[model samples]
Target: MLKIRLKRAGQKKKPFYKIVLMKSLSKREGKHIIEFGYYNPLKKFAYINKLLVYKYLNHGCYPTNTVRHLLYRLTQNKINVK
Candidate 1:
């Protein structure tokens, strides 16, 4: 099944994450279908393409726990890192 999750990136200490769409069993930083958002925990920043996110959501895409929390924050306009 297609799933939405975070792909770790950036340097060792400063971690960055790309919110991506990919096969459930794929590797964490492996090939992804698409990248629709990003998160930088240290900076308390996040960005998400709501249009694409909701589109995939309606099409049965599942988001990880962390991504789900981010989405909730997005909907509430709490973490607008764009």
Candidate 2:
């Protein structure tokens, strides 16, 4: 299964995350199929690729809980909820 998730990066105590597309069984920081965007927790900022995210979401690519929450917050105005 393919997953849209976050890969931790940046220095200790000051973390950033890369939104990545990877196989579900792979290591969290392992090779990824693609990088979608960035999330900076400290800055409370996120950069996302909406097109790719929507494509994957429609094709059954699941997002991690954290990623899903972030997307919900960011794209609430654009996405239709059932």
Candidate 3:
């Protein structure tokens, strides 16, 4: 099954994350089908591309728990921006 989740990146002690689409059995950060967006925890920042995100979501892609929360947050922003 294809899943949507975060892959850890950046330097040690300064974590970043890429929201990705990948096969369920793949290793973390090994390979991904798509690199959708990014998150920086220390800065409390996120940049999610809603177009691609909803495209995957519409196609039955399953998101991780954290990614689900992030998407929930993004929905509000998209609405407010419109």
lDDT at residue 31 of model 2 (Cα atoms): 94
The 10 consecutive residues of candidate 2 with the worst lDDT sum are 73-82
How do the predictions measure up, each by TM-score? 0.90, 0.89, 0.88
lDDT of 2 by residue, 1-82 (tens): 9989999899989999999999999998899998999999999999999899989888888888888888988988444332
CA-lDDT, candidates in order: 0.88, 0.89, 0.85
The whole-model C-alpha lDDT of candidate 2 against the native structure comes to 0.89
* Best candidate, TM-score: 1
- Model 3 scores what on Cα lDDT? 0.85
Model 1 bad stretches (over 4 Å) = 77-82
Tens digit of lDDT per residue, candidate 1, span 1-82?
Answer: 8888999999999999999999999999899999998999999999999999889887878888788889988786432221
RMSD of 1: 5.1
lDDT (10s digit) by residue, model 3, range 1-82: 8888999999999999999999989998779999999999999899988899888877888888788888888776422110
* True-structure RMSD, every candidate: 5.1, 2.3, 4.8
Task: Give the higher-lDDT candidate: 2 or 3.
Answer: 2
lDDT-best of 1 and 2: 2
